[model samples]
Target: MERGTRSVVRDRDVCRRHGVVGVLVEPRSQARCAVVVLGGAEGGLHEADAVALAQEGFAALALAYFGSPGVPSSLVDIPLEYVFRALDLLSARGYASGSIGLLGGSRGGELALLVGSHDERVGSVVSVVGSGVVTAGIDYAAGRLDRILATSGAAWTVAGRRLPHLPYVVPPELVRSIERDEPVSLRDAFAALPTGDELEAISIPVERVRGGVLMVSAGDDGSWDCVGLSEVAAGRLRAADHPYPWAHVVLEGVGHTIAGPPGGPVAPYGPGPGVTFRYGGDPVLTADARAETWRRTVGFLRYTLPRETADEA
Candidate 1:
């Protein structure tokens, strides 16, 4: 698609030579910056969002860490190195390490913050409805259902070692509901987790991030306590006196799924069949929040990772 003088181009084979599963989108003209886009527990390449960013004159890569042919089958113990490979690919495309940003939503949001904290190359981050601490992964296989029903395993790893994580405490009723394939809200399970000094050990250590951070959450998130988690990250940044700009935004009356890009269908929240999840927010309000969140995200990225001027380009 044409965007003023620059036309958008997509390269599905952009990272294939490096054994990375992703699609790269950018303007035919030199891009201003680069961003790595990640999806949540739904697990897939977020190509649409990447294309949207590309239309705005940035090089965007929609990476798939799981639920793809070449990656892990599920969300368990995904290696951070996999993401680094994507960064390396972007770097090879002439984007400086300092010009790269990470954007993610829900579980992907948590992954983005965690990655930014570990990698100095990341210049900016936008985490939507993500967590401030490491949390257990989800395994859907019937044989491993017991493990998932309890604490399960860590969602991420580095150098083949699992990171410390908080475990979910599922109640008996919720377990029964899951067994019966009934619609269930996992919010109660998350609320049942202990809130104490123990959490400090598993915290994301946001102070280590080398660039600006923007944490976005919904006030009425039914999937988990996103607002509280975002606060935890923001508080850490403030306490460290982070040199880069940082802000936390809370969209009231919206739920866990509040990061949709603009110009898309704003469908009402309605769970379809067995084991459906509820996000908790008015349909109209959630639609509004999605649009607002996208605007804020774009503005934040522009501030933190500004595009090159005409002379530089």
Candidate 2:
């Protein structure tokens, strides 16, 4: 939905009231459900994700965890309580139901699983191109110890302490390729994340989740092995015998950034057609999958967190 659409309401700075930095999007009328939208390592609030659900009649708050004014400098030293605060605030909002849902992509997607599994306040989770285990961010390691010329390191920190994370070091050759403006395959840089027995240590405990789960992934995710990781999460849920309805939607030919553009196709950063933006999937295929993924996400939320009132406009 475009800005100034009569059916919608947008508050560019809802975080001020909540003591967080983010955006709030809602329908003009009362909403049947409430959802918290999250963005990944790229930082800032995910305003578009919130607006997308708002257009579908849910009250969505895109809470900023990092990369915004007054937000954390990096993923380090963040607080899970901030997420809980958002959840509690939504619970108190009369326009929405008592329970809350989470929708996130990439790093946001990884966090969606964490909050959904750990916090009973969350009733459902929608993760796109997210991992089953905690993936590290760039600054997580470099910030602590200097002289480590690594590309990807620990990405998350809570209450000033960093979580145990796996690093993806960019090879020296790839670094040179980047300096020379040559195309270096991202696969060469993405580290081989933990697997099999190692997964037991880092994986999120989905069995503890009190609500339904839905995850989306792509086979050719150049960013990381999301499809493989999603399977790990699905397996965890099954092993735990999670009673809630859950599904891992693996879209073929899509990339790590599976969602559709907020308004239009994202512009290439800077002058040349750079390698950094080399997310897989053709425009048509990704768009079709994006629309369908969101359609099912809304459906999953509706089923899991049905409205206490019957006022869907």
Candidate 3:
């Protein structure tokens, strides 16, 4: 495929969830054929990843679960059935010749594993900063402090005690929601949802999955247990003795959000807490880390997704 004159298209269409309209991007070149799906956090798609995948010669689609018309950002409100239905839309649309690869980060990563496990049509799967196991509750208080220090380099204090270094965010509200049966606040509602463990319990075996998998973990990420999450998922796959191909990586320095150049166009979703500012956090691929991530992603798709020529082989 010619690298120049890249073709890209962005449009909205109704997803399998009846009234939900999602955004889809189709990359140019007939040589490489793979449909890359972007998973959103609360509900909307991460636009940066979508653009990056498309630029690398893969058709990318981003599904909006919430913040789209009548959709709600609360994860607990969205039904599991609807999420699968959106995946079915990809296969039904003949994206990737009826078999496409899945890629998601954070919460979307957990969802990708679940949907890919349940569906046979997925050709490959990649999860960035995703966990396969769940913690009893999310710790957001440290996250709040980490955010303050990451950007401003300020010291943090809790209960009148000054801390030497930035702590992870484990907000009490988050814990309260996790333990509460009926979420009284929106924050509680989000926290009350199932962790990765719940998703894993319902997930199918990776060995049984038709597509390969590429799992990436941000070791420096303080929001979740990145190392443990990747290990658990990878361990399960290794134990299954499955035929599917899978690779796992734990990047040492970077966090969950990936930028292009040093601060040039960081991953979309706004300036998150505890996010190290590189190149001013462009929300695009501005940092070297995000650029490397894009390169790796493109390479992975070329190798794992269906190929037409032996050159990629």
Candidate 4:
């Protein structure tokens, strides 16, 4: 797509040189900044969102951590070093280290927070329906319903060591419902995870993030308590007196799966193979929320990671 006089370009092999699976989108004109876009539990490239961002003049990479060729098939023990390689790819493309941002949704949102907290180079973060703490990994290929539970295994590792994470204690009733292909909300399972001091070990250190943070969540999220989780990170930032801007917005009527470019299909709720996933929201309200959220996200990124002038580029 063309943005003004500049045509946007998509490069599928740029990240491959850095040992990462991703698609890079950028305007033919020098990009203003760099952004890494991540997908949630669905696990694949978010190329559409990256392309949208590129149309807005930023270099955007839709990165795939798992469930893709050349990567782990599931979300188990993925190394943070791989993410670092994505950053390296952007850096090699001439984007300043301080101008790079991270954007993600759902489990991808959790990953964004974790990566931003650990990497000082991240200039900004936008998490939609994400968690503030590390959660156990999901094994999609596991036959038993319980094997796919959040408590099954670690999702990420740093320096080859597993990161401490919150393990969901799934109730037997919920397991039975899931097995029966009944509609089930996992919010209770997430809510039942430990709190207070118990969370200190697994909670993402949002205060350590080098730049602004924008977290958006659905109040009626059926998958997890994202509003509460975003608040936890916001609280950390406030307590630390973080210099950069940070805001958490709760879209009152929506459910999980709220992040994406606006004006797409708005199926607020859906049923998976083994269970009916309850993504709660009125279609009209969800559509409005999606537009507002995307606007704010773009504004937040523009403010935090400003575009470069032609001379600077």
Candidate 5:
């Protein structure tokens, strides 16, 4: 790891070099917890976020399942086993077993929940603007929501196969066009997308998750209906009477740009320079939500993963 100042040491695609994939961030000193960070369909390594977590005294890995070298060019056909491989690498490098946590944004958020539910070793899960059930990756054409949804392929892969996924379907009236400035009804879109067998096959069983869970959602998400989706995630956990500690945070004015740790720009226009429309929150509100959610995320992980490993405890 190459030392950056005194707080973090960055290993650039150290995983790829070692026949694994993604980047790993480590604290200069010993860390109490380990975290895996994931980004959305836009697909870059969550290196900044992982480094931020490392700065908070946790070992962190920014895992990229797609859109990076040695990984899939898109979210299509990604093996679920990649996540397990990341955990195995962290364990081999001295992060404690079963003390690992997952933090994901957007599509990553959906995955964090799925992985946490499937693996007992995951100590906690933090999702930002995530989906409750499996969702298909829609290739946005200059077409209507319903038209594109019917044609978009599966977003995730498992055991070398694709799992069923919810499509992005909205009635024509509710969604005018993707390129224009028009209001879309996320609720309507989600309601249309959740196919019976598809949702059943891919929905994460929150009751089975082996650790604490935290979900952060924005009420007016432009990218997807994260507010609706987050509520669905929490609702499932509650319906299951989940034994593990869990909570949900709804930011009233914010939208899809709520990724990143505390101390970054508020980003009213979503992420990047080309963000033409409002994601959801105004600058002040989005900024505040970003800081607050990140703080809460760290606290939740600390509560679940202590200085001593779970096995030792």
Candidate 6:
């Protein structure tokens, strides 16, 4: 199957566990069935992006773990176990065999790593601005609060909008729970989350995983320390002596989100300090970078995905 627009299932219940729902999207062709899980923090799938993947010959499934009000969309809210449940559901549906691959960004990136680490079914993964383990050094929650306060106080502009102060604080109750380790602390859970250790601890048959990974990062992802997360993940991969084919690319002058070059169609930024160059909502790259990265990602997938090898260009 080649690139073509076709209908695929969307927003359908794939599975449920612990009051969380796993939504699925099924691609048209059975020749290759691959699911791309979205980051809970980013909400739902962009209809355009979903369609694009289907056209590219993938059974792209955007699993929604959060985004529902009060359900906890932040990395802290959802447990790594939820991602595993989504993977399991797809496996039961016969989505793919040998190993499953997952894609995630921001907080979702962390979740993807968690799933790929513990679940043997995960074939490969692409984590955009994600971390291998959640540790106390990051202080993500506090960092988020600090950034919000700083942005509020700074003089910034975006698309003519004045800098905005984002005064947000985690609910006190949630904070209390985290401190008490009631149930399980998010940081503790994340640090303890299985995946980044030696392959023995990781369920995926890494050597068999063809594409391995594509880790991408930006200069200023929305998070307080996106760079730290990226670095930590990269370090883990190296420490583990990962043998699978993998590449890590950190784009300069870009934020957590992908954006086009600064002068051309500048990506929309929120009104806040550093907002002018903070996050990106558009694709950014020189023709060469764009072409090369695209080629690499496609080639990597083609080499890794079992179906792609059988269908050789």
In the order shown, what is each candidate's alpha-carbon RMSD?
A: 3.1, 4.2, 11.4, 2.5, 3.3, 12.0
**Which stretches of model 5 miss by more than 4 angstroms?**
138-150, 170-199, 263-265, 270-278, 310-313
Residues 1-313, model 4: lDDT tens digits: 3342337888876777788998888888788689999998878889899988988878899999998988998899999889988988987877776689999999999999988988877899999999888888888777544557743689999999999987767788888888777777767565455678887888889899899999999988888888888788888888999999999899998867579899865676675536677777777888888888899999999999856733486
TM-score of each: 0.91, 0.84, 0.65, 0.93, 0.86, 0.61
**Candidate order (lDDT):** 4, 1, 5, 2, 3, 6
lDDT of 4 at 258: 70
Clashing pairs in 1: none
Q: Highest lDDT: which candidate?
A: 4
**How many clashes show up per model?**
0, 3, 33, 0, 0, 13
In terms of TM-score, how similar is model 4 to the real structure? 0.93
Q: Which ten residues in a row have the lowest lDDT in candidate 3?
A: 182-191
On residues 82-122, what C-alpha lDDT tens digit does candidate 5 reach at each position?
Answer: 88888888777766656899999988999898888777878
Question: lDDT for every model?
Answer: 0.81, 0.71, 0.53, 0.84, 0.75, 0.48
Best by TM-score: 4
Candidate 6 local lDDT, 1-313, one digit each (tens):
2233466555443444323454455566553656555553445443344444555666566566554443443333345565666666766666555445677666566556656655666767776666543322212233433343322221112234332221234455534543454331122112123333432332222223233766666554444344555565666566667777776787655544441112222343433221222344234543234344334545555556666422342
On the 0 to 100 scale, the lDDT of residue 83 in model 4 is 91
RMSD of 1: 3.1
For model 1, what is the C-alpha lDDT against the true structure? 0.81
Model 5 vs truth, CA RMSD: 3.3
- Using lDDT as the measure, name the better of candidate 2 and candidate 6: 2
Q: What is the number of residue pairs that collide in model 2?
A: 3
Q: Candidate 6 deviates by what RMSD?
A: 12.0
Any idea what lDDT model 4 has?
0.84
